[model samples]
Target: MPSTDDLGSVVDAAVRARLDDSGQACDAAERFIVADDLYDGFVEKFTAALLDRRSGAPLSSVAAAGTLARQVAAAVAAGATLHTEGERRGAHFPAGVLTGLTTEHATARQELSGPAAMVFRAAGEADALRIANDTPYALGWYVFTTDSARAGRVAGGIEAGMAFVNGVGAEDAELPFGGVKRSGSGREPGRPGIEEFVGKKLVRTVA
Candidate 1:
């Protein structure tokens, strides 16, 4: 997936996805799996972008912010390195990035509910997919690549219900919005969502 040439746009889209709704959205991207070749550069740019662009908005409540701050602290206690702009104050949890986390870490499997990102260095495509699909929560997944075939293949391989390629904020009213696995079932705002409310009765009349 390192075939992605535009690092700037990818970083922008990634930050947008991670910070959306102050990282409270269930579908917001929580983990970033970067190919080994791009991992360092990606993390550097990503952390910078997060620090510079974060809206500094309060989460739902002060208690909610405290919970998120504790989550990040726990990750650090568990050996993950943290690169952050500022400490949590009130309901505004400043943007931070976590590195050196592995699939075995407890925080690796948990979702951060604030503007924080956990980055993993993947050896290649297979490793990337493994990290991406390892979680039980599969509401939304994102793939950034220049190759169309690779994009399709990676997107198809993702376990999430919705896969966004090369961009963020692609959700529309007409599109089905939902997740698979523990993220929840069924769709909304689309044909499938409509069917969820409909009752079907089987009637067979032989002529």
Candidate 2:
């Protein structure tokens, strides 16, 4: 059987094909960097303050997404590998075979608000957990595994407010959504969803 990441790529490809069929090539993908050898391929692009990835906009006047601006700058400073998918066209960014991420890098610690991803290398479950928790923010997390027992164990250790386990898009109206640390301060659904927005008052008088 293919690895989960491989399966994920296949799914991504399928989604891209569907998007192409719908004539939305410039719509589905946002420009971002992918580095295989952080030091060799990604640093120079940053020194000149040039865009390391490709975006759909036709003009160079286009700027990086504000949400990702800081994170991208951090990645560049940490010297992580960065590049676009092809010859750097259309706010072009690296699009395939993403690799070369380290927990020590700022990219690993920061919350990426735009179309960016970091692929860190971890030794095992414990190490992965440590890396995951090393960050200050824990809005959400994901666990993809066939073993239910392992899933439960990992889920419990993760500090995030929401977790999607085993399956993707596994959300419902009844489940409360919120986060800890800097992710969120309150819940948005379930009973707490309405409760957070409400104010209750009571009065008593002798008759």
Candidate 3:
């Protein structure tokens, strides 16, 4: 078993390494001092019991999965760019495996399940629509509406590149997948998804 002091040192080293890799440089004194403080704070909040080896009250894996999925989906809707780094962890699985599996451009309507759906429902249509539109990774977004007619109107009002009526993950090859803002620089799937990887050259024609 690693001593508390040893664990603290390890976390400190990890933080320093991350900062260094990100092109950050600080005096060793500052790094050590700050790292110690952060390590202490972390330990205070998260003790050895929280460690993977320790057993405690169990968490619902289903709920955990739902929460994670929703968070990822929300990030996508917010126009955030999703990229992969390091050893291609499971976090990259969704975007990597799903990107080209379907049409060139497709909208994924992911229905919230279990507690996740309740969370989404609580957000109300306006908030839900806003989250859906603002997320960067969204090709299209959907939520089940109490009123299909109302949902149709609301979908039309949404600013997302695409919107679905009480539907989730309804993507079409002919359609486009992209988001506004920080979602990414361009679209994917269809001509847009293709354009992300290719550049255009304009030719001048003289008659």
Candidate 4:
């Protein structure tokens, strides 16, 4: 798992990259779930970025350019507020990182499509686990801790297709990638990836 220092650095990067002009693109902004006590800097940077009017071209050109843009636009129209950074209404919708969110909020229940984040605060590890498990979607899971054993425990406990313990940036082509519950039903890459296509047949003989 990413240690407190790594977590802090990631948040610090987010804080530093608060705007398009600040040399950080939307993708660079990692959707986070840091502790409430350790969120002062994250909140500041994320909020600032969310509210600021970003000025830059599309990330790609070949396909639909404003698909994500349209999604963000529609979300804003649907009464979602940018409480932290940037303007409430604008064409350039900077990444919306919504913190202080609870189970009552709709985003907490469903998967977010755009560059948005729903940060929830848990009282303890059990609370964090409960909160994490409460969601139906489990495409990917990120765990950050200094303890290797604790990381193993958390990683094993999480219901996800891919669980990266210490680092979020690590991805092995040989490793299986898939999700459980609603977010996933099949595996990708490695042996499991190949096995996903092979149909299992069981012949029952009555004797």
The lDDT leader among the candidates is 1
Clashing pairs counted in every model: 0, 15, 24, 11
Decide which is better by TM-score, 3 or 4. 4
| RMSD list, candidates in order | 1.3, 8.6, 20.5, 5.9
Q: What's the TM-score of each model vs. the native?
A: 0.95, 0.63, 0.34, 0.67
List candidate 4 segments past 4 Å from native: 1-3, 12-31, 45-92, 199-207
Q: Give the TM-score of candidate 3.
A: 0.34
Off by over 4 Å in 2: 1-70, 86-98, 201-207
Query: Residue by residue across 1-207, what tens digits does model 2's lDDT show?
Result: 001333344234322322231212221222212222332223333212222332343322225343344566567677775543444233433232223566777667765433344445555667667767787777666565556776788788888787666443445788777789876678878888888889988888889
C-alpha lDDT of residue 56 in model 1: 67
lDDT of 4: 0.55
Rank by lDDT, descending? Answer: 1, 4, 2, 3
lDDT scores in order: 0.88, 0.49, 0.35, 0.55
Instruction: Give the clashing residue pairs of candidate 1, or none.
Output: none
- Cα misplacement distance, residue 21 of candidate 4 (Å): 18
The best candidate by TM-score is 1
Please write out the lDDT profile of model 1 over residues 1-207, one tens digit for every residue. Answer: 446888988999989989999999888889999999999999999999998999768999999988888888888999999998767789988999999988888888887888989999999888889888888789988888888988898999989999988888899988999999898999997898888899999999999
